[model samples]
Target: MLIREATEADWPVIWPFFHDITAAGETFTYPFDLGRDEARGWWLLPPPDRTVVAVDEAGTVLGTAKMNANHHGNGAHVASASYMVDPAHRHRGVGRALCEHTLQWAREQGYRAMQFNAVVETNLPAVALYRSLGFEVLGTLPEGFRHPRHGYVGLHIMHRAL
Candidate 1:
């Protein structure tokens, strides 16, 4: 798969699954009621930040990831990111590829570290993936998220040095 910068044209392709994933209220911190315009504004970040799409040989967008500084001003040395894999394309290593791409990008950009501020604790596959990629859970905020079915659950703050 080829991972490349996303364009506005890609938003139509991304929004369906994006809606499903966000509306599911299982992983992301985005509000469940996030609408198209607002979601687009949130996901398609501007310069100095990067948003990429992982596409198959046919150019089908399999997943997307957004990478940026974890904080502004004095704390900008650290990077942070978010990912979303098309539901139909899950389990095919798309997420891993997106993640690895982001790591490389962060390292190349001279980030001191990469942190994921709010990984849902019950998202086991993602937590395991992050662990395998060398991210450590710095801490968990007790009852940080209200999972649709699981009630309140912790949100893991995971990190890894570049």
Candidate 2:
């Protein structure tokens, strides 16, 4: 799949999976009821940060990622990123490709480290993927998320040096 900078036009195609993923209320911390316009703003980040989509040869956007500084000023050296893969495309390496791309981008941007602030502990596939990519869990907030099916679950703070 080809990973490239996302364009405004991609929003329409992206919104469907994005909405489904968020509405699932099983992984992301975003409000399940978050509106489309607000989600567009949140996912399609501004300059200095980046938003990208991974597409197949047919140009089907299979996944997306948004990356930026974890914090401003003193914390600017650290980076952060979030990913969303079309559910139909899971187990096909779309998420892994997006993650590897983010790591490369972070390194190229001179970020000292990258952090994922809210990885749901019950999302075992993601947890394992992050681990395979060298991200370590710094800590977990007990009962941090109210998963739709699992009740309360821990939220992990995962990190790795670039």
Alpha carbon lDDT of each predicted model: 0.97, 0.96
Per residue, candidate 2 scores C-alpha lDDT tens digits across 25-144 of 999999999999999999999999999999999999999999999999999999999999998888899999999999999999999999999999999999999999999999999999
For model 2, the stretches where C-alpha displacement exceeds 4 angstroms are: none
TM-score of each: 0.99, 0.99
Write out the backbone clash pairs for model 1.
none
Judged by lDDT against the true structure, how good is candidate 2? 0.96
Ten contiguous residues minimizing lDDT sum, candidate 2: 83-92
Give the per-residue lDDT digits (tens) of candidate 1, residues 9-96. 9999999999999999999989999999999999999989999999999999999999999999998999999999999999999999
Clashing pairs in 2: none
